[model samples]
Target: MSNVTRYLCAAAYLDSGFRDKVLAELLFDQFRAIPPSYGGFDLMPVIYHCRRSRMMLVVRDALITGFFVIGCFMAPLSTFGWLWTLVPFALLTVDGIRRGPLIVRALIWFWACYSVFSLIFLAIMTALIPAAAYLFASGLPFSGLYGSGSTGSVLQQFLIPVVTLGIALVYRIAIYLTLVGSLKPGAPEPIIATTHPRLARRLDYIRRAQWGNVTMYANEDAFMGAGRIQRNWSIAVELDRVRESHKPSRRADPVDIDPVELHAFVRGRLIEMRDRVLRPNEGIQRLDIGDHVVTRGIFTVADGQRDRAAGAHPMIDRNGLPRFQATAEEIAAIARHPQGGVRYYQRVTINNAGQEIRDLDGNLVAPAEDQEALTSAFIYLAVEGRMLYTQFVVTVLPPAHDHYHVVDSLPTMTSGRVTWEALKVLKLQLLRDVLAAPVRVVRTAVESVRQSAMTPNPRDHIVYPYGARLSVRELGASESLQTHIQVLDVGKYIKMIEQRLTEAVLDFLEERKVETGAYRMQAAGITVSAGNGGTVNVPMAFGEHASATVNGLRPGT
Candidate 1:
């Protein structure tokens, strides 16, 4: 009794200061009283917040108990006195009932003892209560005892306790706590308030888990937080009510993506079962495939650079002049039949492994050239694009066996449920009548990084030459199939990287002696014309080209 009475008086005397100290002490005494932390001791704000919260709790408890004592004194007189007693009593009861922070609820419990003692003392004072027995009995009052008495005499003494209890009870009836509970944040909530009620059923995920319901997916620490919150909400929603997904999720089977090439158009981009996709690199001035993310962007490379050569002959010159002389090289590159036209073959194939090939006879077929030959090829061969564009010529030639009985046009191959066994079993023979030397091996694309002011054109391509140890023209870069892969084409950058690949390759090729075996050499749009007319010019692309090749070019064939 002495200890509790002194504590109440001490609380009232020290008020704010003592309450804070008590809270600080309580937090240390009980580990669970402290809120959960993110474990960043480096963050002062978090530490301060925790300290402040605990202090507030302690102070609230102290002040409420003090007021409860005062309310006990006032209860004998008026209704307002009950408000004081009831407010603090209800506060303590609710804190305890709700399982508030452990230590805080304990302190509130201690306050309840104060009210109980007041009631016990009043009970002892009433004649109905055995005063001598009460004095001899179990415990001291929560409130202090001033003196002792007989039952009849105790009644007068308890008059004050009786009024205090009534006031406290009445006040508690008038007020109640509206909000106080756990803080579970960022959980996905039902969008029930949305204008389109039908939409909530699709978007809302009920969280059933203790923290949340949604399944979180992440290997990284920071991003995992978002996943955790999402998982919580997913668990919250009523899963039974959610509609089944309209389309099958793409991640079901990864093997299906391998056949994507079979369906994509020649030079077309394709995405796989992962739902991953790609786009041109925005870092460079000229559009380029910068990000090499797998599962997508496999077809992201461009087939060829844009041609910028001056047209040799036009139907009519834009100037008031007639033009006639045809650029012989350009003309020769194109094969014209007596009909003055060309016959091209195109095909597309779809491969579905282990699955029965649906007969899309002619439906999935596409061809260019003679209608009958194209149709037959489409009807027979596997029509695939990347294979045609990269692995084989888009147009089939002689001796490449057609799938079935010979036809006048082209042929291709498709995989229905192609197996490892199926590929090795088949080897189509070729007729050797027509053959040619290969020219160039396409290199990965590069981009220039020259500022606009420095290079007039930001798209100026930069190619570093190992043999010459210098840079060259845009068309030369294109012809070499090299790309300038940055926003600017800086000379220093060109100088630094140009020699990198060259020296490695030159050092290799120089180690081997030259041989004449029908070698095909490609130029950087650079050439010395062998015109029958005898006039020839080194292509404009030859500035650093002649230099770049000096070391590799043999003195005499």
Candidate 2:
């Protein structure tokens, strides 16, 4: 077409299908090696034209009633012309790239190339079809027979289609060999760049292991969703790309994986995968579609550790290990022993209060005097390649801050049914403590009462017994002179325990406050001395009595 004609076509496109059709062609050119006639154009002008068209908001009506038809019905059309699939793919590829996964760039390229080629083949068929029809046209000299008497022979007619089909086969093979992970043996595979050091390491080994596939997700959610916080591990994978493509039967018999060992094995597999892609000698990898996955990604290092710490270790004697104190290596060792393949890991984020928490009730996490301590117990549940969950427990010990006592444990779960429900159980104990704390001691003629109860743990088979005893000190006495006791039990407690080694602290405060109040009141002309003893004096008749009582004061004064 002439330049003027083309410009006119472009201008009119805002109100027609020309714009979309042209853009589709341009996208095809960007991704495929098709000629310009097939939509190749410099990007600048194409981008400009696209912006203009979008602003106009000119909608073009499709030949079909629906604005979108996702090509499933195009199978019948395939017999007529395989080009239908290709055209839609080119358009879809352009749209997808403008707003979708660029990682699938190669797949789109494959689609564009194959579609363009299909179009070419169909065009050839269209041309030959006309010529063939002309020969067998009605009333032609050879119309009486299957073919009109033309220069072409019966062999030539059948031969043309076969040759075209063979060309199509070759086209498909060339694209696959060049674009897929088929690197010549001894040739190095081009490594995929990733920001994470761990990911990069995995990729290097994936290539070395000759696995043809490797995918990585830096954040928790991309193609998958883990969580939004760093509390969750970043995800990654290295596998045989060809095997993935073949849609091989899902992993038979779970492959035993020691998360630590797989952590190493993954590095090897990624290196091999990269090498095969970069350097294929008739293809560096010998992987086929039906082959099982010899490699996969790695996650949950901390989870495994946490699980073992929460008493999930298989071999170690349950009684021997310290509560929630197992180290990472110890946990990793348990899974590695005896060759029963299992792999998982766990991480922790500890927030410790200044002093050991004997008890807590919101603002203050107090210091326990002796055997009490405080801590957050986190558990990670990771099994095989899936099912991830996290559990949390806060432990409170004594004021010495030396050792952690299992005073309270609370459990929480994330992702799925978690193995760390033990955390929740601890919280329940704490709640019970606060609800019934300070077992009341009252002055009674009868002997003091002592009470105790036993608590049981589901994850641990230990019985927690709490004891409380009340006794009265004898001195002298009026009915009111003896001590009075009040019982306390605070439940739903956040946890706080305070200790003060002093006598009648509140009574002392009351006497001091009354003396101060009397001094202030007298300076304004009111009664007796500003206080020598625990009592404040007052005058009688005009104001008040001149006698005073000690250690007793009304709260309002």
Candidate 3:
């Protein structure tokens, strides 16, 4: 419940596309759940924000309509009678539309632009029409159509507003239908938790899962879409059973090793490193050991069938979830026939000391127990045949932008601040709203119709390469790490994980009775090169023409 999470919730309330993608698009009907990888943060707060905003809109719209009706009744008594009523009506209407769906908000903008141009044209015509009529009546014989007072008053008082409203209605319906018809079928329904109890439960489950478990993903990058890659390096070494001698001798057989056992041994050592930091408040905030599988991407049953026909692994279960973890038999088989699509990793997440976000009233916005860390580092280790592969990656998750955190700074009901704030907002927006009401009404109506007619399907129609790609946390994260301390922590954790991983692998190799002369040499070279911010090319044999290149910090920098 950091400010990043709060900002994301506010963003979901404002942007329908983002809300639908996180709450609906990533869900699987069979499991009735969102994939762990895609849903990396809490979602209940987001749902709450959306529902609250919708309710507020309803109240605001009702107030605006009431005032508008009163204004219409008072129009005959005074020349500017409707002008007083327009203030509150327009103000409320503008606020309501701003909190509405993104599509409607965008349409309102276009309509406002068009209305401005139309009003200017009508104003010029209103002035010219009366002058032209006077000149014609004085110069020519006919005086029938030369009454300037009545005509000018009629045009100014009635025609301008009437024409603007008329154009808004026509334009709204046209754009609404075009956008609605173009929408993809089977889109996710609006997340109305009260109206849809089942969706609310699903959201709760996703929130709990994010907190209680480590989500998995099958992708090309060691840690894809996590955040910026702060640091990364890999090391590979050839293995042999016989000890090296100064004189030439017969070649010995290669050592037989279980890749699974080797992976477990290294993983256990990394876990021990995590265990050494017993005080959770002192060192790493989170440490998880899990199999990090690599695949082209998550695919559906249809994709699996297509791949099966092409004589390749389908990579999915009958339930349509991706086969992220391999079975013991599958692992053993892959170890015997080594490939690139499977890897095991140890993830270490470190918490950096940063200032917490506070509201305008100076209250902490995030909960005490649920403040998520912004930095995470990953260690990938795999033993394939005679070559051992190890990679270390660091990613930083920055806080969301300032604007999206407006929800935290809004006034509350205590001390009558809400009412006072509302009055102030009305005063500021009254004039602008007077001119924007017609366009707002047209846009709101169109949006309402679209929502009612096109009810979204709960079940998503997922296709290959169309499933969820980016994570919600990553999507809302800032462009880079926020502070100098965060950057320092990134380097600290990378080096820590790297030291533990290297020691674990070297020990495991020696315990297997394998020659470590070449491995030691390569390790020393890699350490020196990395310390100096350079690259080390280590030639490793996997299948044929396979080589591994270890880079320092990043490939180029």
Instruction: Pick the TM-score winner.
Output: 3
Candidate 1 global Cα RMSD:
35.0
lDDT of 1: 0.23
**Could you tell me which residue pairs clash in candidate 3?**
none
> What's each prediction's clash count?
41, 77, 0
Cα lDDT of model 2 by residue, 11-88, tens digit: 322222444444443331111111111011122332344434433322111111111122223222333343233343
List the candidate 3 regions with Cα displacement exceeding 4 Å: 1-4, 13-40, 51-225, 241-251, 277-285, 298-344, 353-373, 403-463, 525-556
lDDT of each structure?
0.23, 0.27, 0.51
TM-scores, all models, native as reference: 0.15, 0.15, 0.58
In Å, residue 185's CA in model 3 sits off its true spot by 40
Q: Scored by Cα lDDT, where does model 3 land?
A: 0.51
Cα deviation in Å at residue 453, candidate 1?
Answer: 60
Worst 10 residues of 2 by lDDT: 468-477
lDDT of 3 by residue, 429-514 (tens): 44444445545556768866875675443224343442235466666666766566555556566677777777877788777666
lDDT of 2: 0.27
RMSD of 2: 37.7
User: Pairing residues by index, what is the TM-score of model 2?
Assistant: 0.15
Give residue 126's lDDT in candidate 2 (0 to 100): 42
